[model samples]
Target: MKTLINFAVILFFAIAFNGIAYSNDECSFNGIDDVLYFQENSISNLREITVEACVKVNSFSARKSGANEIWQFIIFKKNQLDHFNEGFAIYLDEKNERFATSVASAKGIQAVIVDKKHSVELGRWYRLRMSANSKEIKFFVDGVLVKSAPTGFPLDFDSEELFIGGRTKILKDKDFEGRFCGSIKNIKIWSKVLDEDD
Candidate 1:
């Protein structure tokens, strides 16, 4: 009976290990040909991302067609920018034309980090955390909140055919123009706002 129990224990261990590995299936969209993608159909945060081709997107926002459809908390220090200066951006090309949302700075008010202030910091990771009901945008670098936007900004919209690694031409019409270049990862989407408390 002891030997039988030992065999059962080993079998259970094998099953458990496989289960852990299976749970690690995060959403992904990479390559030059790649265009757009949104993890959730509605506004939620498990983690969402908006990035370019040949890059990885780890975002809590879902890629969508309208404004604020994505979970990307963009930072625009200036109006016009060179490709190299083009940081993370998004826009809506349809009916709703909105731009310039409100955001706050945090942790030393660091310049475009994770990419270069605007672009995704090379070989770096970023996390965007927020609440469901509140308009709190927190930017995290390597799992740290370096900057943030309070609330009542450009405001979220409804659209699809979204763009990553840069904004679509229509976005330019709204004033958010720039094709971002770099790598991205870890798109988390949550049902409600997740912070130190939750």
Candidate 2:
């Protein structure tokens, strides 16, 4: 009887801890060609959403595109399109030294680019979170509110697959656009907008 009780206690604690971890939505990434893809029916008709990630940049440099150098960290992307104006993504623009969060709605591509006074340091871990509702979207870094912008319209997309660490190839010319050069972990996505308490 004592052994049975001890086993039950262990099982209870294990279940409780597992539930906590699942609610946190933790995921780790290798930051190379590594990508996480979600099934088509996993999420649909999202009115409000939140995405969070803890990331460490391994390097900061730009890939040459003719005369221009583009340095960016493609954090998250949903849907496929020929250009940046066709989908939703949250990325770090190293060339501009800012965080760019964009959503392609029926109106157009609405983006909020927040410039940081200090450049992000490589090899250091930072927590980045973006929350969006019908009215506005909020960007947070390390638990501090960094920027907020009008959402413009409801976020609607037809793509069934969601990509992490890089974007899905929309155009052949843009295929190489979203390769991140760092490590990402503890990625979480929520269907509803999260507030301070969440």
Candidate 3:
């Protein structure tokens, strides 16, 4: 009996360490969306996802242009926004630049801010996801569709080193200048497209 318990514990750790697929009973990665997933309960009162889970992201579809762009909650480098060069972006503009979408503007949200610290509805627990598909880039907040990027967005990513809550400094000379402050969890990623229902 003791051996059985030990085996079970070892198996659990092994699977987790190897990034095993989740059981059908649990949430699976959505391929149609083809986006990054980050959830946190402490920050939004739902689930808490650590920012360290996703550090490097170059290509995302929030495909928007102009003063307003899509806003996908991501755990990017905190200091990346200090100079507003290019930190982990949700709604990309052309190649790999994340821009503010109109949806955020219409909702009265800037969607993009360069600072050492920022907070939203603390204790609400939020789930943020973003991805790039054949059509356009997409973004979701709390599992609810928030916005999409402008049509005809190029599907090209330049960065490679991906980090949770941190963005790469490839497109621009900007780096994270602030300490990422948030909870991140349940990180699942794939190199394929995700379905809407996924």
Maximum-TM-score candidate: 2
Q: Model 2: runs farther than 4 Å from truth? A: 1-32, 62-71, 79-86, 169-171, 174-176
- The best-first sequence of candidates by lDDT reads 2, 3, 1
Compose the digit string of candidate 1's lDDT tens values, residues 87-147. 2232211112211222222212212222232344333434433221234444333344445
Q: What TM-score should be assigned to candidate 1?
A: 0.37
Relative to the true structure, candidate 3 reaches a TM of 0.39
The alpha-carbon deviation from the true structure for residue 135 of candidate 2, after best TM-score superposition, in angstroms, is 0.7
- Give the clash count for each candidate: 49, 0, 58
Cα lDDT for residue 89, candidate 3: 45
Question: Model 2, 59-162: lDDT tens per residue?
Answer: 65533232224435455445334444434566767665555566666556675647484457777888887787668888888888877888777775555556
User: Is 1 or 3 the stronger prediction by TM-score?
Assistant: 3
Q: Please name the candidate that would achieve the greatest lDDT relative to the true structure.
A: 2
lDDT (Cα) of model 1: 0.29
* Deviation in Å, model 1, residue 133 alpha carbon: 4.2
